[model samples]
Target chain A: MSASDDIWILGISMTKFGKHADRDVVDLGAEAITAALADAGITMNDVGVFAAGNLMGSAGIAQQLQKQIGQTGIPAYNVSNACATGATALRTAIMAVKAGETDIGLACGVEKLAGAGLLGAGGQEKSVGHEWTPSGRYGAVGPIDGRIGTEAMPGVFAQIGMEYLHDHQYGGTAFELFARISEKNHSHSTLNPLAAYSKAMPLEQIMNDIMIAYPNTRPMCSANCDGASAAVVVSGEKLRTLSLEQQRRAVKVSASILTSDPFEQACQVLPNINTLTRNAAEQAYEQAGVGPDDLDLVELHDCFATAELVHYDNLMLCEEGGAVDFFESGAPWRDGRMPVNVSGGLQSKGHPVSATGIANIWEVCQHVRGEGGPRQIEGAKVGLAHVIGLGSACGVHILEKSGLAA
Target chain B: MSTATTIPFVDYLVLEPEPHLIAHECTGCGARYFDRRNACAGCFATEFRDVDVASDGIVRSFTIVTFAAPGVEVPFVAALVDCDGTSVRGNIVNCPPDPEHVTLGMAVRLTTVAVGADDNGVQAVNYGFEPR
Candidate 1:
């Protein structure tokens, strides 16, 4: 790998992942950014640019954050791509560094979902009792049940589960296995004091809980969390100038892939999930010269736990119908072949929308640097962080061990 | 709520023979998107043209709600109808607007129907899916 191929995460930080009604968006964003700067052992003066990620904050959130954080004169900007907003900010930072625009940059994302409290897009026309009253609607199509109207996120994904069952009879046991996966993540979250919900739930409890959607339950859905995460990315040559101690622990970003939704590929029944994720993952592997099997860990988009099962095959870690079998194999466990999530994931750790993607990246950087504490995979040299926004847009990034990026 | 005619009251009301719903399609990506778009979300193609979505499809799934929390609904079926391969989660008309009739995977069609005369004495047609 050339010197130009080198890029390392200088530092990463995140606020507690939970509903902090007392705090506002700017406070969270500033806290995460300042914490990241301190962790990187650098001052704000070292950062040449700023990329903030936010969704549904009160208008002009980017400008407001800059003023709040006192990063006034800097190139403060915001990037929005739904759930992938955070990671997209990180990508912009990486591009800036790669294009010789800056030596150090920051990608920080914050969300205040609990504050919004149901920003219902389901506005109804007033009824003076003239015509029939319709239910909450989606698009030109009026209100319908199960598809979108008030259905649980996992419940909506269950339609795919039904289709999956029809396509391949992946059974009840597969869900039980996913519960085990969640259990492992919860155990990790318990060690992570900043995590929203850290209680380790039993597999049986998840399997038998009242269904939110068929074959889906409340536990399978990622909670609508409120929090923030920040990361500092720097050129590889910059790391080389650091002390031996810092050099030993520096993590390198190998590849970053950002993409929009495919041609009318609806979230429900996304035909060729394998091809979509695999295509993106393949580009990352090729750019990084690393394969999926070589990855020490991954933080996939488990917005719905079932999607995690589906992605096992989509990421080409297993065959088409092999997710159930692979899950049953227990190879994706913390102590198993390749520990995934280990950070509780969205399932247990929580999903703060715009902040999830970068949070995943920040966790990977820590894991690769042997700083993941209890959730750390033993001898992790390569890690991947994945996020698929609204089951539409997606991104996958590969991070290498210190001094191993090409 | 009954707009039923008594003695052949077809003097002022005239129903179109070929009832159709106006919609837009992205010429760039050959995908049928109901809402209008300046660029194709699929392929980023800038070309598009107006199209009439066949008011027909199978009712994929549905639910009927009776407003009890001080709401104004006599009763209506919230139908998810798949129109000509494009599954649209919309409402169904023609029936008594009951959930039982709005069965899952039932054949349906999309068409413009004039419910009644509006305040201006002109026809007010809305797009809805109904059993074929």
Candidate 2:
């Protein structure tokens, strides 16, 4: 990529992540966009393109949101890849800027899940499409028979956890390790004012919480919340046009990669062991010219406690089946080396599906800018953000402090 | 009283005297999938043929779901059963949904059971694996 192709994150903003029953999806989205524009010190007219992502909203959400925030009639796109919706939207914006199609672009993600039923209905009036229904729903339109037709999301992860335990020979220690992860995330949340749950939760409380699925309690699962996050990115030429102060605060987008799961023998039997995440992370590291060991901080998807543990290996932060030992070594702690999820992650910050990926980006950008107050990692330079959706897809991004400004 | 007619819980199930799940195998790469595919993921081969999966297999993994869709009973055993070379996901019927009974690698045989009823009052028969 040429210097002209480089994309710089000019501004990032996120709404407080928690239940907002009164707010609708558009309201959440508009607020984030307005804030991002204000933070970038650029007006809506300066934004040449707009990209939006959400799982539940109808089509043309980007235009709808832009209409609410002064429609410049710039080209707008709506991107969706399940939980990776936010990052996908960001990737779209990066593509637009890097392609020289636009000088300034905005990527935003908003989801209103509070008070919605277990599925977090995004207020979509009609079903848009159908895929393999997990066991819970009645009408599963696939060929596999004699398969459990009613297992919900929690159950699916529980099975994964069970397989991990059985394969790693962890026995009872696996559950303990999971609780420790929850505890660590909860502790991290205490320092994150934007998190949904800022109060630290004890390991015992997490372990003893009502079991939604075997090996997973209430705290072990990411909560459904209503939130939105947005980022503004501009091309390197546009960065030169910015004020000196803004340039100093800007973060460079080193790499962004998105991938999907390949068809394998079975849904559970991932071809290369969570290949989607691994491939995305590997591509991101190569593009950024940095490996897992070089990452100063990371905000990975933790929809389930077990997912965080599995992703440790998937992201190559540790060797396969070494997540337990990694957790015990305090390597992922807020003050420890390679601190992760210091923005409280999805577990404590709440996962509003479409907003999750951008929320991860917001956290990473904060650390890279040295703006993370209480949870700030000292002298953090390189940061990574990762998110996955089970349909399924994964997105990974690497951000570094701009050397030109620093 | 209306007599309940038995129907395959899922459309792909062939509910005969000896029940077995249907799978589509790619002729080019010998890869199998429960759903129809336009192209084989392994070899990108388009040709496929229908085959019946084995009735018995070992439990690769299992979980007791405490919450599920409405009208679906909770606390049921959902498992991934390896039937011969293929892995099948289904509920473990005729066995308790506890770790003591639903251990990994436990042998299980396939059987048909009532999952629920359709709108027309026909009983939906679904297949599941049970301890052999």
Candidate 3:
């Protein structure tokens, strides 16, 4: 869609990202959706389409969510693309509006991942031992993970981080540098009251924490928690009819891009987090008509401490192989020239998987609309939100502050 | 050499002619893959040939994992080894999982390990790399 026919985010809301033992996915989903609808000053009747994202839940989260709120029976679309599920859901709604099939749309992502350990391990560790035993009809298959390197998220991201440093030869201090990146995100989380962790993690603590993988300690990993985030999108023409308050808070969707791997020779076995992310970032910049330097802030996926550093390069926030230099310059700090993950990032804000995608966009929206309180990037105009899932899907979105007057 | 009683954990690993990994090298573009592929990712070539990979490789990247799910051992070196032109993912065994023991570009050779054994006296063998 062109800039003139832009889709605007009229309202967005996120439940405080943390463990909710008492609440299920539908409970959290309904809460965020209700809050977003209220923020838009509209009811479910006004929503023309609905998209819901939940990674570890049963089928039809959108219908279940509607049952909690008002059931308008709008065309519901369920989406799940690993950690990018939320962004995928938001794009579904945005696409509906962009296609002229609807003027107003609603999207939400929710997940309950508290105490879910090591993401992809999926309780396989329980049966794992030096010698595999006959557990099922498939027979004794031992732990395939450690046996054939690792498909675990921690190991994958750790390899990706170290591989970048290896390719660049940054004076052989990958561990300390990665820890410092985690320190910045944890520090940023302190200002984000909604983050799962609001206390700043000292760099030494991050460096010394029990290592999940080399260069990535336990605290350096994204915390698994239960949370939900939702957004309301309306066509530019339809948004013009809204009240002054609604129009003032609207954030324009500059670009929405998603990408998957393009078949590289060596990256087949190892997850190529770099190529797909770079492709998405490049397309996003072209679509938005803005380079990385124009971004006032960023909320790229920091699934691991290693991930954030590489994404600096992936997002073109620095020169080729200049991620180390970018961090050294302190440009990604909360008050630095190009602030990033001011909402604690996935590292500290908590990655509820599906919730993270829209949560990242919600962070950008907060800063662009001047709604960010303590963590605000002053006079922020444009921002980017990014997330990547290892089954190999990436979503990059560019958002801008509303320029129209009531 | 593996006998009739042992089985390679993954199909790509060949146990008879020495512990080495094989790739589905695309005849069109020479792209290598461990898993079965319908077509070449690079040039969309439908034909592939079994190419035996070089046994020795350089450590392109590695991670010393200290934490994992319950029952999994810790402090193992998981590494990505570049065997000649192909990239191989496996564990670095027969050495300490530490910075002093494992560094980038360390020379290593592929080796086989007995992962598990069933009641029929058959063993499941997996491939790993060790310091050369």
Q: What would the per-residue lDDT of candidate 1 be over residues A38-113, giving only the tens digit for each residue?
A: 8888877788778887887776666777777665477877888777889888888888878777788888888977
Q: Give the per-residue lDDT digits (tens) of candidate 2, residues A1-406.
A: 2335588899999999998888788999989988988888898989888889988777878988977888888888999887889999998888888888888989999998775545521111222343223242333433232145333566666677666666676655556677788899999999999888888999989988887766678788887889999999999888888898789889989988889877667763422237788889989999989999999998988887877887887898888888777877899998888798998877789999999988898898888888988778888999999998777889999999877755
Residue B26, model 1, lDDT: 70
> Which of the predicted structures, 2 or 3, would earn the higher DockQ when compared with the native?
3
Could you give the candidate ranking by DockQ, starting with the highest? Answer: 3, 2, 1
Candidate 1 pairs with clashing backbones:
B55-B109, B55-B110, B56-B109, B56-B110, B57-B108
Order the candidate numbers by lDDT, best to worst: 3, 2, 1
TM-score of each candidate?
0.77, 0.90, 0.95
Model 3 spans with C-alpha error above 4 angstroms: A1-4, A122-141, B1-3
The TM-score measured for candidate 3 stands at 0.95
Evaluate candidate 2 and give its CAPRI docking class based on DockQ: acceptable
Task: Give per-residue CA lDDT, model 3, range B22-119, as digits (tens).
Answer: 88898998998877778888998899999999999998899988877666667678898999989989999999899888988889999988876755
**Candidate 1 lDDT by residue in tens digits, B51-126:** 6655667755444432211222334455445566655544566787442454455687665544444333334445
In model 3 chain A, the worst 10-residue window by lDDT is A131-140
Q: What is the lDDT of residue A384 in candidate 2?
A: 92
